[model samples]
Target chain A: MRNILILLSFMFILLSCSKEEKEDLPKDPIILPPYNPTYVDLNDRLPSYLPRMDIPADNKTTIEGIELGRALFYEPLLSGDGTQSCGSCHNQSYGFTDNGKKFSTGIDQVEGNRNSMQIINAGLRTSFFWDGRAATLEDQAFGPVTNPIEMHEKWPRAVAKINDISTYREMGYKAFGVVQLDSVLISKAIAQFERSIISGNSKYDRWKKGEYQMTPQEDYGRKLFNKDRDEIRDSLGNVIQVIPGADCFHCHGDLSDFTDNLFHNNGMDEIFTDPGREKVTGNAYDRGKFKVPTLRNIEHTAPYMHDGRFKTLDEVIDHYSDGLVHSATIDPLMKNVDIGGVRLSLSEKAALKAFLLTLSDPDFLDNPDYSEPPPL
Target chain B: MNMNTVSKITAILMLVTSLALTSCSKEEEMGCWPPLDVPGDSANVIMIFNATTNGQPLELLKNFKDPLGRTMQVELLKFYVSNVFVSFNGASTLLKKAALVILVDPNVTDTTKKHNEIALKIPYGNYDRITFSVGLDVVQNAGDPTKYPSAHPLSINQNTYWDAWGKYKFFMIEGKGDWDGDGTLTNIYGYHTGFDECYRSISFEKMLTLDATNSNETLNVNFEVNDVFFGKDTLDMKLHPSWHGDINTIETAFIISDNFQEGLRLN
Candidate 1:
């Protein structure tokens, strides 16, 4: 009996010590260092490097949400006819832009009023749409899906279709903790995927990061592009200070994206037919004015202007250089100044074009992450 | 069983007693404070804008008060006042909580149908002082349109203004007035406005005390439009000149700053 009691006590001590040891064990184990490249490998590359996306506190990004958004972006179920998707107009090969079309084709072969704006680096834009109708990318996503001529589907119907899909239903639940979906969640998901489509690995970015060097002509063009335009007064009567001389930055400022978020009547046309901004505002001074387009991937987003009138960069530069027409609502900066229009020399224009080309990131266009997903 | 065992047991008992005593004392200390619940009998004040002349409600377009106090027919009365601060029992607590502020247009079809109402949900408490601005602050007026739902409609109003257009209309008053040349067919504008520099701040602190039980109560504050043109600075409704913004005439500014406040009568 004594030996048996001693044996039992020994067994209890051993068991308790082992249990405590197990409880105290570290959770994570050290592993070998991950393979990192010293230089960016042109071949077999990873995803594009995106700048920090400014997400609202209300909307947070998740992998599952982005995945669901990607599916919705490519899925034709979002359209009434089940034929058109966001990817239809935003083809990846053409830098997520419908090539050189005067206007993008929507559902039932219906055409939109303006050309499809390129989605390259669209995440960096402060506002969306040529008229600056939508304030955020999420709001922009809500536009085409509900437009009668575009997707031709109500938000509820589109969300119902997404909810019907088992994969999306699961994804929705995982991301937002609810299988039921709404326009807010739908827009949030699409915005997440769009925010992930950042295009920062361009030649210009590489040069800026000291990874690559710009050619002499390209360097000259960069100087002219960044050249401060003459000081111009905004529609609000505040004097806008610009550097260099052309004051292009007055509308397109120096930032990650070049738009200043200001509406202007840039003297695009003499006639006041469209009355672009005046349609929104009953004010007489806003007639024929429109928001300025960003110049990040301006080389790819051709057929420029609110109406998509100009086809080539040369034509666009020429218009800015000489084709400025005067009007009652013309921007005061363009009034009575010989240099109101762009007056770049031939070499300067060529250099500018070269510099603009540097804005194009081959890595962004070829990013597999932004491409179609593998066969599900 | 042994001396050491007795000492160990006594020490353990004392430790347990000390822990219990400490916990009880801590609980007593925590329990000594009372919970803060704002009383519900706080007066719910609603400002009612009414057109009146000499303490009598004026008709829509007739019997309006002129600069000379003569009974003259007038058309429009619009002006903007900004930087409003409300005080509770003469104490400054207007900005303490997020107050629900709305612009209720009595002339709007739906608003008029709904008794010409805009409601802001304020915390339940005693407030003797109610202050508000006629115009928006520069930050509120110039914030990102997507941030605020109230500002969204005006920013994206297809028939009004675009999101990029950084101007907000505080008050728009339009009607036909007697012209210098011809007759009553002429359009006179009494656009009272506040934007940027034209922002005016109005504050009112009343000595009245309110007692609110556990139920909701309302205080109806009335504004006389005729009294807005009274005092040393008078507004000529027939001439209906533009005041505030770019066309800030001295008479308009004085009318906006002084006479408008004189018309406020809180009941």
Candidate 2:
């Protein structure tokens, strides 16, 4: 009986010790305030799934990397003629797309094949360019720099120019651990800065987060956006399901980043014969297809289409409503749908346009970080 | 019974406790449940493609028949097959690792480096049924290329047809076809299909049981190219059917039929 009492006392002591250890475990650290230049407490407000910007294993992002990238992005020395920077085509005031032309002119007044894609919320994009050619923002950065029509500078020369600057040299070394530059390191730094150009503070975003209410017309437009159109038939006279009508979601579907990242021949103009995608594949069937651009800031990034054929959102809507041209390669979903040729009522068009305008993010346009580097 | 006897008993108890603690310390130093030196086994399967017609080895790009039975020269031949899932008694394994590889001049009979194409390492396991598709997944095909390297073949310039569209050529089947009067010159025609609609899924139960033991093994898979074209209903490429570009019509028929299954010969 005395031994049993001793054993029970020892067990009780061990249990108490375990309980104390459990209580002593530390809790997770609380995130501090002043999330950025502003004193906004954003720890609780940020979305959990916001894509973590990819930093190359080789060149990681740092304060110096962002600063150097911003300077290079704004500097004209990146161009072959030393006249245009990436900022020339992607101006902050115009939603990161040039407002002056249908197709932005590059070096020597050479015209690009496609309209300038808007860079608003581009950080969230899974692929860059209408063709989805470049896989990363870094890869896309090298295109305009090297394209004969664009900045027109070879990668080696571009890297050499950046290496010449001591500030950039030091910044590159500090950020990527090398004063000498390469395409990979250059692209990484530029991509890091580009990823920082996030734009989610739109009224639509507010509505999604349940922070704001939509107007009655805007509500109706949203309903139409989700509803399917009437059944349509293809050029071959095959019946096609048209459940979701003028739903932009059919193409530019994702709520946050509007592009679906799929290529389609949306029956813009049948006779143009540009052979948009076919040129890439050499297949007779792939002709006339082009990637659907994002609709996040579609209101500002007009004239639309690969060639900037449509001047206004109304024209684009009209094209979708009643302007569809029958072709062998037209998307099956786009077959004889009453849309692309059907005329929407003026008031309905106005409401739809209003709904599109809600997508414009004021914070992105005014973000100080996205602006030109403050004088040195 | 005296104080000296009590001191000796105390020393024995202390020694026992010290030995128990030392054993435990050694165990801690050895660390976690499983020891570091334990050996684990895995399987690796290599797929080999050889193109042959009848008993003779047929050149993929060079030989083609025209209406008058005339020979035609060809240049390139490539195609895409994705969503490859291997099953052992109806369980899926890592299949996305299978992707497109270009076979330039598949018809060349020279036992040189041209004929050999192999996919990289797949974790070793017993797979009785191996199934693969002729096209990409809808989500994967449509998803932005910026996220992953595998999504965009053009980014690496793996696909030759990278200019007309930014998309990776899902499939490139190029060869010489019979022309009206164009003589012995190589006439290149390619069948490259991609986009969400073009996505095709093919699942087949591999009859051969794969045994992954100590060493890696290669599963020699022989595909008769003609089988893909000659189905229960022979699809004559010369007819130039309107449904060639129509993915919906072709993908449904191709995925369900035994045409793709019969074409696969595993040794």
Candidate 3:
């Protein structure tokens, strides 16, 4: 009986010691499972001629990170209420833009002030947003989640929700090799996913590579789109000859990017309402300027312009044709403004739309890689 | 590893970090580190730009009569101070130079901060002269603020640099003037000074001795409000009510910028 008591005491000590060690395993760096990060490689995928993306050193593209980001992106759990996600506004079917909606509805069903833009080829771009307020994609992700009218969720609560889930911990470890869930790591992962959403495989790209052919009207529109000169003029502002091309290339030029990536006061209105770039840059001269968006996937993305005032491409073409309002801060690129606009005829407007359609890549929109993953 | 081992490792790491920080602090005790240095002990000076009415800090929103008996109330005063070249000796050689541009808003005063404080850390010695440029020199002022990081001093958010005008506003001030002197401040008077022609570098030759024992000083760099309008060329509020970044305000811009140099006093 005495020997039996000593044996039982020895067994109890072993059991208690093992339990204590198990509780403290996470604290012990040596005992924890080695965090093997899934590295993402995209060297061969991107075109050679295009300049390399300026990815932040801290947030390198990782396969696990991008996958986790895409999962977080589609998961409505990130919203204030588990009802809306980034994919809700930026639907993949519409080239990662709003689904023909003028303004996207938030969690509270409140409409946004500006048009939701597609972040295709965003990694190559320097500044983020229409006003270029957010400097980086990582910085830009912080906006919609906390904006009072948008997601309406505080970052602390959003991070806490993701931390509560066991799957996120596993995914976080795979991406960052660190189990700690923070807003910075979350932002970086989302930025990586955004940067990976490249839209360079359009019909126009294939046409440039001599892989496809454009329709007659589409070809005419392409010519007008790249039109830099509107007839040669003398020292005086007189039209020596009536140039019949749409002078749209100056502000929206550079073939591959399809945008100058600069802000312009494109004679939208005579008076300022939503002081676009002027809010970021306090200069009075920049009162009406806004960042020029890329023309890629223009057909899929509708309700054009920053405010989404024009519903269709025809209305947009009409604005540049004759509806341009003269402003004191008008860009010098609006050279034909003396005659009101480019004055594209009825047939010319239709042709411009045809050419814009060639920029849409159906393959990109239907890519399963871009689609939301199956339930975790 | 167990809890005991983890605690031991943390304590060792803390000790190492404490020692490393102490070594760095010892080196920072000297005013100038790495390249620029002088024999004497280094000292720091906290400079303030104040709007004054008869040698006293001028209060905004309070109507005061100027020398011309014009009732005025200074609503806003903002300017940039950069290219701080301090000369210890009477010679052309500069004692120390700080290559930084800082915005100074007199309305918000906390002398320790970047916006309010214009610190000068120079070698402790008696000097015949001290000089600095009031505005960004030609090269420093060049570059689109949009290209720079958002948090930088000369970023577009400050409203100092105008891309359309292609220049930085060296000094800006606004006030309400009662031109008729009926004691009612109705009319607004603004002097938005800038352009390449207005950028001025002023030099003050005064006998200033640095106390080696007490290696710190606070200097009052007063920008007399009246001097900006009345010196050399008086502002014609009737002719130009608001002088913005246009060709119309070039004359007033020159007058106000010229007075900025003449209005200085290192107290």
Residue pairs in collision within model 3: none
Candidate 2, A123: how far from true, in Å? 3.7
What do the candidate models score in CA lDDT, each in turn?
A: 0.56, 0.57, 0.68
The DockQ figures for the candidates are 0.02, 0.02, 0.02
Per-residue C-alpha lDDT of model 1 across residues B8-50, encoded as one tens digit per residue: 9999999999998875533123321111123343444344445
lDDT of 2 by residue, B1-267 (tens): 999999999999999999988755331334211111212443444556555544345553436444345454334445555555667777766434335544553212235443335442444555677666655565445433333342233222133222213334455444444444555332223344555444545554564443454335555656555554464445444332112233334442343234544665666
Tens-place lDDT digits, model 3, residues B1-267: 999999999999999999988865322333221223445577776665666775667765556777788887775577766655556544543433322223323223235545545656667667776677766767656745443332344544444654334566677676566777766554555566766677788677766667777677776677677887777677666444545444533676777888777887777
Kept native contacts, fraction for each prediction? 0.00, 0.00, 0.00
The TM-scores, one per candidate, come to 0.50, 0.55, 0.55
| lDDT of each residue in A1-376, candidate 1, tens digit only | 9976885585445335431223322222222122221221121221232222346566566676777678777877888888888988887766677777768877867787777777765655556776566778889988888787788887667766665565665565556655455677777778777777766677877886789899999987776665533333464645464323233543554343455445677767778757776765565656777867667667677778777788998887777766787665565434212344656668877887888888887777788878877534
Please give, for residues A80-197, the per-residue lDDT of candidate 2 as tens digits: 8888889899887767887746898988898887888878655556567775667678888877888889899877667666656666655655565443556666777777677667
Off by over 4 Å in 2: A1-46, A49-55, A153-164, A180-184, A232-244, A337-348, B1-267
**Native A-B contact fraction in model 3:** 0.00
Supply candidate 1's per-residue lDDT for A45: 27
